[model samples]
Target: MGDGDRRLTVNGSLRSVPANPPRSLLDVLRYDLGLTGTKYGCGEGRCGACTVLLDGVPVNACQIPVDEVGDRSITTVEGLASRGELNAVQQAFAELGAFQCGFCTPGMIVRATALLRDDPSPSETEIRAALNGNLCRCCGYPRIVRAVERASEIGRSGGGRP
Candidate 1:
């Protein structure tokens, strides 16, 4: 289907957005839908700042087209929380002070959320690997890693995945 004809579920809601077929999912999410939580760090997808979950797997929103996302469930950083409660990864980032300047935190948290969902008991190495696509200029990698680890623990302990 054409970009303007594409429809998908975003953050648990259905949205029919307009795009240019080549337009990135990042643009549709941010400009078309106003889900600005997903940042645009590296347009090349080298940075995870534009990360979002496509069917619960972390993918660079900057690399995917709106037409390619038809009928799939897309979860942006804005969807991570609900009803005024933060998700586990968000809480972990806050408790562990995982961000500086906070530009990359949203993508990091979204990626971490996927990691925890796939493996609620990932080791430090696994966490690092999962977050390899994301880059933080603030040099907050250490704390971000710890936050993922903590979020994993929280999930394992039946904390409702935050």
Candidate 2:
């Protein structure tokens, strides 16, 4: 709570970090707090690999400074799950084999999670548009889009308990 320290609510927990020597939220999450699920891709905000939820909205963590995060809950890929079970999007991704390299899976999952929250049943075009920012070098776009559709199905069926 002091000027020399910065506090953040991450994954439903309150954490403190040094305020001086400002760094991006990605660095704070990966290095400072040891929450490595949020990846670092293209330090600029172009790549969605560093996507995280800033108070329920998806954003590129690499573009956000830790000092500016003050009090907003940060939900990383690690935070998408509740209890010990995977969320609907995560379950669909795993069940449908949506990822190849898996490096971009975290961001894809996080972004898809937000998309599903807003639209429980997004069309193929909608899903593709939603995930357009997130890149998958393995060319897994088809599977990824299907996984989002599958997630919508799972959510509507109440099978995944999302």
Whose TM-score is greatest here? 2
TM-score of 2: 0.96
- Tens digit of lDDT per residue, candidate 2, span 1-162? 688887889999998888879899999999989999899879898879999999999999999988788788999999888888999999999999999889899999999999999999899999999998998888899999999999999999997744
Q: How does each model score on lDDT?
A: 0.87, 0.91
lDDT assessment of candidate 2: 0.91
Model 1 misses residue 7 by how many Å? 1.6
Candidate 1 per-residue C-alpha lDDT over 122-148 given as tens digits, one digit per residue, 9 for 90 to 100 = 899998999998999999899999888
Q: Tell me model 1's lDDT, rounded to 2 decimals.
A: 0.87
Superposed by TM-score, candidate 1 places the C-alpha of residue 90 at a distance from the truth, in angstroms, of 0.6
Q: Root-mean-square deviation of each candidate, in angstroms?
A: 2.2, 1.2
Candidate 2 — worst ten consecutive residues by lDDT sum? 1-10
